[model samples]
Every structure is written in structure tokens, then in C-alpha cells.
Target: MTFQSTTSGIWIPLITPFKAGELDESSLRRLVKHYSSIGLRGFVLAATTGEGQTLDDAELERLASVCADETSHCSCEMPIYLGVSGSDPRKVEKRFQQTKHWPIDGYLISGPNYLRPSQDGVKRHYEFLAGSTERPIMIYNIPYRTGVNVLNETMLELAALPNIVGLKDCCGSPEQSYDLLRCAPKDFSVLTGEDPFFYNAMVHGAKGAILTGAHVLAHVHLEICEDLHNGHQKLALEKWNRVVHIPRLLFVEPSPAPVKHWLWRQGLIDSPEVRLPMLPIGDSLAGKIDAAVNLQGGTDWRI
Candidate 1:
């Protein structure tokens, strides 16, 4: 169940399915089952798009366990990266200790959110966590949510670590992302966490992406990456142009809300329920997604 940066491509930070205020294990399992058939590089459980902040440890583990079970049945194994974030390094260390034996192949950890530590502090935070566990780590550099960007220099320093293999980059600065991508070591993969930036990142030699919008139009996303790899730039741009608006549309509301509604509308998930503080997509957005979904050819994505 080992995973490395070389094979990283189009990882989906799955939307956590919920039913009646409880973890919807049934829908969760079904989602994994369907995605396993897709040509995705991997799955990220309980990530930002998965509403990781709202999930308890037990709920999160169920996510990993179910995904693990479903992937085990597939001919090709799908690597599962569990998402965990904290404001303190020591607390993050404790999280490593807790999920150290989960079914996941590795971890996707975010920087100290809300606390907004200094660059040195942030570096030391990941330094401790990377050394805390033997499993590979994908540093989630989503400064907008975490409130502290991991600068390219600091990221390069972290990339030197053996376990810190890649980044879920959402630094919100194209210049910064390009700088890091150019400076990053060949082995240090850079996967954009910004859904709308996927094409730009790929064009900039990003290893891939951990996209939420990928929950819908996933095969199209996969194809765009393939086109880049196969040197079909023209084809890639054409495909990207056609669906580039989907990412922004999904975020018209607040993230996984629109994404969940899209999936629910497609019958990929039973419900589009997000936890408190994150509500379901409003009717207006739902209508837009519904029309877009129909325009995308009425589900049957797995058929």
C-alpha cells in the first residue's frame, strides 16, 4: 500500500456523505466503490472538501476503513491519504500517534490553522510531524484557510525531508505556486488543491491535484491530465476550456455544498448534507448545478 510522488495524479478530496446528522457509511462506501473504477490516482479521506473539520475520529476512521475495503477489491490498489490538521505541532504529533495504524497509506496534513504561526514555526511544525511517523506525508499548504502560507523557501526545506513527499498547494498566488513548482525537487510532487487552478498547475509541471470539483466531471479532469502527459496540449486546453467554469460554479456557494449537491443530483451520493456552519447548496445554485449536470450528459458516469 505504499505511494510516492511520481504516480500522484488527480487525487479526489472526497465529499463526506452524511444522513440525518450521522456519518452516512452506506453512501460513503458507494462513493468509494464508484470512484475506484475511475482512473484517479488516489483518494483523500476527510479532507477539507470531505468536511474533515466536522468529523470525529471515529467517523474519520470509518471513512478510511470503508475506502480501504472498497479499494482492496479493485484490481489496482487506490492509495488513501487521511487528512488531519491542527493549530499546534504537538497536537498534530498526537494525531499522528492516533492514526498511525489506520488503513491509510499516508497522511495529508494542513498547516496550523487560525493560529497563523511564523514561517520558522510552521517549518518546525511540519518538521516534527514528518519525523513523528514513518508514513509518507503530503503537506497541505492551503494558506487561505490555514491563514499562514508556507513560503517556497520553507517548502523547499521541507521537501528535503524523506517523508514529506509532496504538497496540496493552495497558496492562492500563481507566482508563488510557479516559483515553488520550478524550485521543487523532482521527487517533491506538487498537487494543486485549488480546483480552478488545476490546468494552470498542470501546465506549470505540477505532479497533479487534489481537487474537490473532481467529485464531478472526474473523467474529464483525468483526461486533461492525460492529454498533458501525452503532449496533446491542444486537446488538453480544449477540454479544460469546456469545463473550466465548473470549478468556479461549484464554489458559487461554499465548496462541498455545491459539490455535494452535484453528486447527490447525479445519484452518486444519497444526500448532500454538510455539517453545521456549512449548509447544503441553496436552490439557486442547485438549479445551476442541475442544468450543468444535465449539460454534462445526465450522469451515467460509471455506466
Candidate 2:
């Protein structure tokens, strides 16, 4: 089946909702249903925002099934992309083979973590994956998390492969990100994974954003993308101003913790449970989030 391409617009790197140390299937369903009604274009499951590191294969499978099932009932097109990351090329390949047949449309894969391969090694790593599967793969160039930067030159080489579609760019350097956006192939996408970079990225010709903040304010995020897409820079910047201080609060602690806490407080999810090594937000951050939530009287905050 040919799934729709999610190369543009406000896509959510969805937060995995858990309750009492278990995957909350009901909340997962609710999230898909709710976000679909909003203007957000796509959903990325079990990724950085979804707490992919802590989940087991069984749970990952279940998460894909539930998200795909829920999205199936929506009137809008919400492509479900599963996240795959590892330090070893062979293991990542095996991992993709494990879940390739699941209900997801494609994979959001990161460069090898920790080992920090050279540009050549990164090139070969993605080359191997693109050759190993016909599934659409979005390169996740998050140098801070993955420890290796997939440079623009190497990325162009990988982008030549038919199945290696686009990128979730968190390369961390504004110069590098802008250069990639300017130099990337026409069919290749450069969607900023950094929520705070949305306006700037769009200004620099980024196709769109895959932001975690959209999980809380999809309408706000989507309006930003729409304005920019329609050449309404003033309106886009105005809408983006409302979110200038958001990423700081959302990422005050470790990610998804603060995002999960905000969702929990809004009653969108059952609990703000995060895995060990990834704790829930503390009182100070919680108080800040509460104040933000109180600003707009719910999840639709202007903060």
C-alpha cells in the first residue's frame, strides 16, 4: 500500500501515555482521535517524544496497532511513523525487519547513538538500511542524542536512494540546518524536530515541523505552518510569538516528562508516568506548567 507522504506541516512526535507502569492503550486511542481532528498533519509514535527507549517489543507492537487502528477511523490523513534507533548498524537493521510489517507507514531512524561514527560511517550506515528495506525511511539527524552528525553532503548522497525519503532534523547547528535546507534535494524533506525552531525553519524553507509542543497546541502550531506556507509571514510570526517561551518549559526537565505532566494535568492522559532514568517533573516545573495551562484555561494555552 502507498501511504501518503508526511513531508510538510505540523506533525506531532507523539508522547506515549502510560498509567501505573503499563502502556495506556485507552489514552493512546484518545490522543489519536483528538489530534486527528486538529490540523496537525501526521503522528510519529514511539520516538523521542513517545519514550521509545523504555518500551519493549511487545509494547511497541501494541502501540503501533492501537495508533494505526485509531487513526484508521479519522476523516483526515494522519500518517503513523514508527521510531527506530540504535548504536549498531546491524542491530538497527534487524530491529527494522522486526517491525517492518506492522501497521506503520514508515520509520523515523536516528544515526548510531554514542559511537559517533564519521561522516563516511554514517553514510554507509544509512545506505545499508535503505538497501535492506523498501519501506520509506526518514533520517533523524539529532546529533545531540545520536552523537554523530549526518552532514548535508552525506545526507544528499543518502537522499538519492528512493526509499530514504526525508529527515527529522535536530542537527543543533543553525548554520548546518539552514545549509541543509538550502542544499537538500527537491523530493527530500527537512522537517525541524526542534519545536523552538519552527518559525525560523519555515522561514529558511524547511518543509515543516515535527514538534512535540503540537501535542498540546496543534491549532497554534498548524496556524504557524499554514501562515508561512501561504506567505503570511507577519501572521505566522505573530502566532509563533505565543509559543516563543514554550519549548523552554516543555523541555525544562528531560523531555516527555514535562510534556506528559502537562497532558496529565489537562486530563488528556491518565498519568504522567515516565520510565526509570526518566523521571516525572518536580514541583517547580509542575507549578510553571500549571500556570501556563491556567493561561488559556486548558490544553489550548496561549503560553
Best lDDT among the predictions, by candidate number: 1
Native-to-model Cα distance after best TM-score fit, residue 144 in candidate 2, in Å: 1.0
Q: lDDT per model, in order?
A: 0.87, 0.85
Estimate TM-scores for all models.
0.96, 0.95
In order, what is each prediction's RMSD in angstroms?
A: 1.6, 2.6
| Model 1 alpha-carbon miss at residue 104, Å | 0.8
Segments in model 1 whose C-alpha atoms lie over 4 Å from true places: 5-7, 300-303
Candidate 1 per-residue lDDT over residues 44-91, each given as its tens digit: 888889889898889888888888998899876688888888887788
Off by over 4 Å in 2: 1-4, 299-303
| Predicted candidate 2 versus true structure: per-residue lDDT over 1-303, tens digit per residue | 233256667789999988889999888887888888777878888899898989999999999999889888888878888899887778988987898789988889999989877899999988998888877889999888777899999999999988888899999999999999888888888899888887899899988889888878778877777787788999989888877897889988999999988888787888889998899899999999999888858853212
Q: Pick the candidate with the highest TM-score.
A: 1
Worst 10 residues of 2 by lDDT: 1-10
